[model samples]
Target: MAFSADELRVLRRALATALNPAPLQGEDVQDCLRLAEAVDDAVREAGRLRAFLLADLARYREALPGSLPGYLELLQDALAAGYDPAVDDLAALRALRANPRAAVLLDRCQVLAERSVRARLARVTQTAVATTPRPRVRLLALPGGRAADEPKPTPAPPPAERPVPKPSEVFPPRRRPVPPPPPEERAAG
Candidate 1:
């Protein structure tokens, strides 16, 4: 963006007018308009450059762990140059974090990945609700084959309840014979 002598003169005059707040001559007005257009073009060019760098950064990110030579270096350089990380960049970096060799990028990738998820979640929450159809409800009948017009049969009466017997009535105690102490004691007696 090397400005020629004529363009530099015009820019200086434009700046002077902007700072001093003076009414501009016809030529000065033209120069100011040209400078404004140049500023806009510069802004657009900067945006394009950022887009290019971000795209390149994403490509490098995708080639991670087993990336080609200089891929990581390029990615880091892009980060240093303020290239914004895209969702895909964060995802690729997250995938790479599982590699032992990717330890250096793990924390950075994790933070960016978390931010990406939050951003996506915010976007989804802002969208209209999903368009799934509401389910229809219908009546369900019992398994009995009786017709609706027929008289219902009465249910059978329950059996009489039986009383529980005492534990002694259920089981009788058994009698056992007593054994003598010892043969020596019996001989002494």
Candidate 2:
């Protein structure tokens, strides 16, 4: 059963008091803990019930035919049941049919979903762009106050100096460095 607003409010107040208290009677403390656990269990059960209903609805839609009248009736029922037909009912219908009407509904649902996604993506893109630093586009004033699009002046390179030799390059060259003379010294060359 759904929790009434008054009951939820009372529970919230009790939880807040329990959480903030320095001490309480053992019975009161136990009651608070028990109530909290019950609330959690109730929420879990509600979620499970919702999921079961959705699955059953999907199965029902899949088993139903896709004529215009039938589709309209299904849409009406779904709406009356507080389901979003575009997002929820249409997907179930798509899984059920190869008919033209089913294909149309599927296409419509996809378009709706795409538009919703695009809107969300646009908002995120806008937010990201707003947060990023934009490159400064400076206009150079030429002689006689004419603005010119000259290439940006690159910073001068550091004064050139002789490159230091790497460790390997600095080392003495070994023409075919003896192959580590052999474990046994050959008879005096």
Candidate 3:
């Protein structure tokens, strides 16, 4: 959610009040409530914007592979809305590389995709260390309260570790070529 500087300041003050409970004046209470409502409104607006952008991206992604009218324009709009190109997008762009417009779109998608990945990496690096490992707590019942027929707790099996594929294996340079049409079918067509 996007917040103005004033809103953020108000939010910080509200949080401080919450963390340290004190008798607040009626004016302060009303201000805090108003700020909370404003924050909620901002959050809802952001959510709506996000949903619209995602739907737009999906529409372009689906249309790009077809010979639909305005698909190219749709692609440009999607890129502007922060669409992350997938492998399919790359392949489609490659196929359409002969078209100058497609080439421009391809270059834009490549740059956007690289920037997107870098931004994600930056966020991950910044917040990764902030996550503290949660302490595992075991609950025990009252002493001498064991049931005679109660089954013993079984240990969980360790998770199997799958080997990570190399980037080359994961993302091949090209898809397998389409097989040639059969001679009989080709002649009929």
Candidate 4:
């Protein structure tokens, strides 16, 4: 598909960014690899989509009208031409010649990109879940640890009889009684 000079420049920039190498630390090797894989997949998918959009835009452009059909058409053309719709923030490009068709195309492209990203993320998430290790907990049962199941120790029986007190000790000796105090002191003093 033929693209305008501006469209070609945008596509070149996008490809450069996509291919650029990102610096990685030792600890980040695995993460970096995952990211690189994901990015590679995304780039491939985006390239395919870009080609398709470009073809559609070419067909639409061949039937271009004198005035703007809508903003959606312009946005579709820009995306089809490989201009990263995500990077284009200024509405001016979308509103070129005040076409509403461009805006609609931008919305559609945004939805498509979001769906693609979600699908990729789901795949990685499922893979991570499958590869993750489960934690193990061990339970040990020791012999004689439980009171109910363990044999009880036999207790010695008490002595046959307690010692009995002797009769002499029970009925001790008796002493002579002392005389009473003086009779007058004894009488209710």
Q: Name the top lDDT candidate.
A: 3
Better of 3 and 4 by TM-score: 3
- Give a tens-digit lDDT track for model 2, residues 5-93: 75576567677776896666686666667767778999898678656666655665656654445554555454444444455566565
lDDT against true structure, model 4: 0.60
lDDT of 3 by residue, 70-102 (tens): 667766766676568767777778778888888
Better of 1 and 4 by lDDT: 1
Give lDDT tens digits, candidate 1, residues 1-189: 667788799988878877999888898888878877887898899789877877776676566656633565666666676554556655665666656545466466567657767988887866634555568888798766766768978999999999999888898777787887799998899
Q: Residue 132's C-alpha lDDT in candidate 3?
A: 61
Name the lDDT value of residue 67 in candidate 1: 68
CA RMSD per model (angstroms): 17.3, 18.2, 20.2, 24.7
Order of quality (TM-score): 1, 3, 2, 4
lDDT of 4 at 112: 63
Worst 10 residues of 2 by lDDT: 143-152
TM-scores of the candidates in the order shown: 0.44, 0.40, 0.43, 0.28
Q: Which stretches of candidate 2 lie over 4 Å from their true place?
A: 1-20, 66-88, 91-157, 160-189
RMSD in Å for candidate 3, one decimal?
20.2
